[model samples]
Target: MAVNKLVYYIIPLIVLGLIAWWQFGFGGLFENLKGGVKGVIEMAPNVSIGAEEELATEPTIPREHEEAINNLVETIEKMVTSPKKNCFLNYKLLGKNYGTNSGMPSLGEGGTTISFQLKGDKTEMLIAGGAGGKQEVTRLRKEIAGFKPCVIAGSNEITKNFFNRYLGQGQILGDNYKPVSIINIFYDTDGDNGNAIRVPEFGNEPVNDEGDNFEDEGWLFKAEDGSICFFPTNKVMSADDDGLVYGNINQINTKVGVVGSGLDYCYTWTE
Candidate 1:
């Protein structure tokens, strides 16, 4: 009888011990395991830390304008640098035009016209006029021929070759070379009494015979109609030959109004 009683007592104690282990001891073990897993996660790569910073403010231009500008820049870059497309040329106009009654001067008040006299590896007469008089228009057409299509390439080798031929060698019409003319126009839209823009200086002195002048400087063209334009004077050669012109367009700041409306923009090219 005593033996039976002792066995019963020992079995109950063992059961109690197992239950305690399953409840408290096992729970503690699982918690330790979970903590170890969390530590591993903390030690893992901080992928988010290497991400680029987000912009503090979003872009102001409409998506369409942004896209159009981007396309224009890309096209210009390809024309400048593409070995195949080296024969092509590009131009751009900046600023906006508001109605006369809107308190903004007409396009005539601005030098909104551009002309070119190109002669080189390829011969062609080409002309593009701004919003002003037919004199600028007619003269521009008489001076140049129709534009030729050039191949567009993305490789640096192709771009280098195009730059060498078009810009470096001046081969647009064989050997005879002429100066490239760039015209800019600016307009004041707000009618702010003292709002006037000074032409930025540009030139290549003692370097090339092209009679480099203020127009040669990379400038932002703002039309009296409030159109903002940018010409890649500094990077024109490279931009035309390379396929990466869009990158430069993104660098422009359009907040500086010419007249007022920022929606006015235009561009063209000659070669």
Candidate 2:
């Protein structure tokens, strides 16, 4: 019995030693384990951070500019809240960039009119004209509902390209291009005055030979009676129109329905 037990124990010990030697032979098993660990580490997500990360940030409007916009908003609120008669805000007229003979067929003018009217419970903004004297853009008030004049600051690629093309090489348009100041103001107490809106900075300057005078950022606000208005920096001058935008009245008005209603509250230059 004792001999049989010793044989059994010796056989088990020899089997255990052979298994250990096979597992650790020439360090190959350990190398395989190390490679598996390395692969797992390589598959892990990276958590390191640096300055190369990209972020989206909105440009900031200056404090004074903010104040100006607030004041303008307040003025608009007052005008729209209490309806008036024989009131209009006029802006220089504009036409399409289409070749000659591309405006009103009868008057040879392309204009727009933007009106603020009280409809039901909400104030409605209505536009009534477009290229060729047709109301092609806006047919319903909701298309332009809640459309209030706003100010936009900050230099962008479009602004840069415009300046580069007009200001010429080495003439850089800085990031500080702000359109905050009031260009003109009209009060509708009188019914005979036609407002002349000067483009705050660029309007007063005559256009150059390269068809770049004052760059109009386009219509800041267009109305339904074929009237249009510009942002303070935008101007209306064309090489084809003899430098005068004719038949274009930048009119912002209540629906007095009068042909020549004067401005009740016109824009006045702040700075």
Candidate 3:
């Protein structure tokens, strides 16, 4: 009877212990314990710990050279965003001294070059040049080709096309269309000829010498050779505010391709 009573008490205690463990065990308890230990350790400071300490040095601020470079960068950025006339004026000033025709033979011919000695890093100098003329522009473009900048080059026509066609726009357009119109159409297309022809709605036909029916419902047609041909449109063509006209050709049942006809081809109508 004594042993039975003892076992009864022991069993109840063990059951209670198991219940407590199940209710308040594992992650919560471990986290609490870890936090408490960390708190205590943090409170107990000045404990000798062996660690490699970097030799203390005075905090270095931007040197005059770096400041000058930064200022130049800012100026270039602002000039790029400014009005075309203002940009041209500034470009002229830069071009005058460093320009291709500038009397300085060291600066090369046809392009404007600007050279400044870095203020802090006195050993090195920074030279930047831009060419607006056709030959110089070509040379500059060739030099920068395949070069990637730490700071992304701001959007231009080429960059915009890359994003809209090469990157995310491909996925978006693919999802929306069954036979997705390839943005590659902007470039070359098989059976389209040399390139897509662009004819102005108000101006003369693109190919003046080649005699064709100009009055007929002319189309800015993409030839099978991947060439674009511009023809006159006899009928009234309507365009949206965005300047995109959506339409279909008789041969192709589905709508495909687009036409830009406004000033500088500003209007783009996609079908």
Best by TM-score: 2
Q: Each model's C-alpha lDDT?
A: 0.31, 0.32, 0.25
Candidates in order, TM-scores: namely 0.20, 0.24, 0.15
RMSD of each: 21.2, 22.6, 25.3
Tens digit of lDDT per residue, candidate 2, span 1-271? 9999999999999897678569887487568766676555446523222321111111232332233333334444433333342133322223333231111111112233333443333444443333333342232333223333322212243234323332223444433123322232211112222222222333423211112212222223322221222332223431121122221222222322344342233333231
Off by over 4 Å in 3: 1-52, 55-62, 85-271
Q: For model 1, how does the per-residue alpha-carbon lDDT over 17-60 read when each residue is reduced to its tens digit? A: 78767876987857866677656545652312222112111113
